[model samples]
Target: MGYCRSKDLDFAFKVFEEMALKGFKRNEVAYTPLIHGLCVARRVDEAMELFAKMKNDDNCYPTVRTYTVLIN
Candidate 1:
């Protein structure tokens, strides 16, 4: 969350990769903050990639709030 909030994509990606290796699953709540951070930073490409990953992942599903955050 701090990584995303600070628009630290490098750290965010590192943390995400670590989580994956550790078998820690992230859901919509996890995604929302990242999306919000990317949007805030105007890193739309990164945000979209994350969103796409969420959609492609069987474990992580987007919620209405996720869409709302992106839209707003």
Candidate 2:
């Protein structure tokens, strides 16, 4: 999230991928930051992809805030 706030999206993504590789099971706590980061970067398309992936890839349901972020 710090990386995201710094607008260091590439590094942010590296951290995100590293977490997955480390076998850490991520939930909204994880997805929200990444999604927010992407959105902050104006990569809304990627954020949307991530939001959808939360369901399709992780089988985790998105919360209201998730939809709100993507929508706005």
Residue 41 lDDT, candidate 2, scale 0-100: 80
Residue lDDT tens for model 1, 1-72: 788767696788788778779988877877788888888888888889889989988777889888988898
Per-residue accuracy of model 2 over 7-56 as CA lDDT, tens digit each: 88889889888988999877887788889989878888899888888877
Instruction: Give the lDDT of residue 7 in candidate 2.
Output: 85
The top-ranked prediction according to TM-score is 2
What is the alpha-carbon lDDT of model 2 when measured against the actual structure?
Answer: 0.82
Residue pairs with backbone overlap in model 2: none
> Model 1 reaches what TM-score against the true structure?
0.82
